[model samples]
Target: TRRHRCRTSASQCSFCEEYILWFSIAQDILKYISPRDEIKLPELELPNINELKQQQLKQQQQLLQQQQQQTLLQSARSSSKPKFTIEMSSGGDNQSTSSSLSLNNEEEVPANMNTIAPVPAAAVAAASTTPELKVENNPDAGIWITSQGVFYFKLNTLHIHLQFFYSVLKELDRIIDIDALYYLLCCLKLLILNDECLETAAKDNRGFLSYCLEKLLVPHIWKIFALGHGHLNECCVPLLLHALNYEPGKTALWNILERDFSSAHWKVRSSAGTRVIALYSLLKPKLIKNNYNVLSVLAYAFLNLITSIEDVEPTVSQKAMCSLETLGDASFKTVMCALEFQFDTVINDRSIILHRLSKLYTILLRNNSTIKILSWEFFLNRFDTLSIESQISMEESGELISPQSIGGFNTESEHFIRKLNQIRFAMAKTDSIKPISSSIRVPSHQRRTTTTVPRQTNVTSDKVETDSIGSFLSPETENSDRSTLQLLVNLLMKFMMKDDQNQVNDDRIMLKQQVTSNI
Candidate 1:
């Protein structure tokens, strides 16, 4: 009949046939990918639910029959007991008579009574009690596979079963494919964004929230970087930003951005800069409030932004500048203070300091309001102080250091000074205060001595020249100069030494010629 129905509705049955084929393929694939230990055995048979039910019913019936037989036996034993007994004269005679009477009664009982013994208490209880059957309904019980081949759970159900969500996180960690991991991240982001209940659930389960924020999302940022680029801002950044809805997530994000901003990798720094901008934009409403806690967070963020403005990477620098611009009036003092601190601290790389100074000068030039707020006099004093220190060091060293040299004369410093002079001159024209001299003044005693030593031998002269050149050059030059000086010194000493044997021979020849002339 079923075959006839299928034949009559072939078009309707085609969909079912196709679905069966697809399901079979999926099962085969699952079997192929599954571990060897999990492989199924064809010879093993699974018990049917109906068979199990029937078996249970038969066992219960057997228990009921046994219980009924025990009850009948117990009643028969109670009724068959002797109602009255006859006694003899003496004690021994009475005992013998009673025993004979019990024996006679036992022999009179039916032979089937031998099989009707008392059942154990545990068996009786088992026979009396019935097994309870419970049915459980779980709507979100299975793994859901999407069209993209990503497996996930329903967002609405994730909050209900947190362990399943954690398992998803674990699976996400195991995924090596970038696209698959990214799809999973997108699903998580959707779960966070769409499920309003998750927030309350996360609040209730702080461990779950912390695990997702710190363990799952934060680590994935670096993992994504390690795997590939171009997806961080799209996949991880928005997810982290959205996660900032929770207080713990906000803290985690702050730590992440802070650590990444100073990362050794430029890519991490650039991404961090971009994240900071997004974070500020997202928190701007709360940041603008007069709350101290929020304001403190803003201060730390602004400090990181200011520090990034001098980043060697142009991407990071531009992002920092854009973030600062977005911050506008709120970050004015923080930026100024941070720049001041950076300028005061002498870093080994003068170029970085110069870069930061140049960026700040550009900002002041672009924004007139910034110029009004900054004290150009203080900067002039600081610049002059640094210039004097550099001059003293240069004069003491007695070598003309190149402006481009690290930890040496910084041309950017002079350029920044000129810009500061222009700003000072422009500002001084309005006020009566005289423009301070931007030129660095070296004390007469601190000046480098230029006295020349008298020229010695060629080797000595060469040694002096090499020494002077090597002093200003890098360490490699110093090594080469030392080697050359040793060679020249050894050659000069060899040339200056006399050959006593040859001198003695020439003296003897002179004496022989004189004696011959005399003869």
Candidate 2:
């Protein structure tokens, strides 16, 4: 029953006895370290894999060759023997005589078939190898990660699982070996990364894993920061993000992210800003409720982190802007609030801030058309007078409003207006295309021109012509005339589309008629 047979100076024994011998030695060492009968930690060491591999390979080859040699010997013996049969009577005496004769024929061989050679014990003990892991608790049952099935743990009801979380945190603190900590992280990652394991854990109504995630993970986030330094442990990001998904942990997440956003290093700030945007993708109205607007915190951070659109470090500004784009409708409210309270002083001095703010507003409008409509109504109806008053104030104080400020504002406003018009025209074109499928038809004259009267009959006097030409030239009427021309152009485009469709249909009918006549 020996897994590894090894000969000692006094006697031959199995590897199991040697293991027991070494295990007792380990226990003695633990006893020496023990203080006043305290429980000792058992640290197991692993054996060298190369030695085991060589020993196993040699054993396999020997087994195969031995099997082959035995097969050849059996063939030789059968070939040497004759294939003759000896008839025997049913009586016991005749049967015994026949059996004795067969045995007498086998006795003619020189060797005894019942004997086996003794195997020499191997020096290497392959069976004694064990995994290299330390356990502070029971040695018989090793450490394992088991999920308590729960999506989240309520703070009041966490008494059932809180102790487990505390125990893990305490053990983690005691572990000074970086390798052990790394293994611990890998084990937890298996818990979160495995979809099947996660589902099973959740279904089993075990909340220990969820409690560790919700309560223990964030407070211990600083440990990762210390170990990883400036670079974040990529393994922890998924868990951190997952924690943020739960409603209870968002506050803690916001605090940690805010701290990083304000770090002395720009790289950390950049990373935090990137996460802000990522978290924004998961933001919902429900998630943003209860006086916790992740978007607003994110918006404030976006503005706080970057000096201007043209920061000394362009990447920082770019990251902030990228995070800003996911702010949804919150962008509109933030911008309006800024314009009312913060803009007048800051806007005149830093043109880059104005430019970035306008870019964010444009993104918001492009995504939500209803916001655009609301914005127009709000600005035109509410802010018109305020804007006029501000303009007057600027005119009065030339020293405050520099040429650079005016130019930047005009440039940013122009870019936003261009984007707005492009979106509007695209919507118009799509609407026109959809309506083209309608069956309604109009007379050619009516479709070609909205005016019913003939040009000659409706001829205007010289004064009327002069007035019309002068009105087109007047600066006061320029906006109105431009809008009027746009309307007319749109109408003309629709009429052209109808004409093209009618001509195509008529050509198809004529071609069919000609084919029928020829037949």
Best by lDDT: 1
User: Candidate 1 on 1-519: residue-level lDDT in tens?
Assistant: 012234554354664455445534643553354333411111211133345557778989999999999889878877885544434334577776777678667855764254223233344344446544221222244322211121223445445535544554566566543444555564554444444324645655444465465556655654554443455335554454445444555465456655676577777766655655544433323223322223333344554555665566667667667655655543454444433332332222122333333444446456542322233233333444344434333544675452222222344565434433332322222221111111112223322243111123333544544433234434423443343343333333432343345544654575455434433
Q: Per-residue error at 117 for model 1, in Å?
A: 57
Poorly placed runs, candidate 2 (over 4 Å) = 1-158, 165-216, 219-258, 293-298, 302-310, 321-356, 362-374, 377-519
Give TM per candidate: 0.30, 0.26
Clashing pairs in 2: 148-206, 148-207, 149-206
1-519, model 2: which lDDT tens digit per residue?
123434554753555445445534643543354333311112111122344457678989999999999889878876875543343344567675777688666756555332122111121122124234221222123211212211223333434233323443444455443444544544444434432233343454344444444446754653564454322355454445444433334445545655664455667656655654443333443323322122323334344433222333457656665556545665445444433222222122122333334444444445543342122222221222223333333444562352112111332454334322322222223221111112112223212233222231223211122222223223433433333233223322333433345545654575455434433
> Any idea what lDDT model 1 has?
0.44
Off by over 4 Å in 1: 1-160, 176-178, 221-238, 262-271, 274-299, 311-519
RMSD of each: 36.0, 32.4
Name the lDDT value of residue 44 in candidate 2: 17
- In model 1, the Cα lDDT at residue 388 comes to 40
User: How many residue pairs clash (N, CA or C atoms closer than 3 angstroms) in each of the candidate models, in the order given?
Assistant: 0, 3
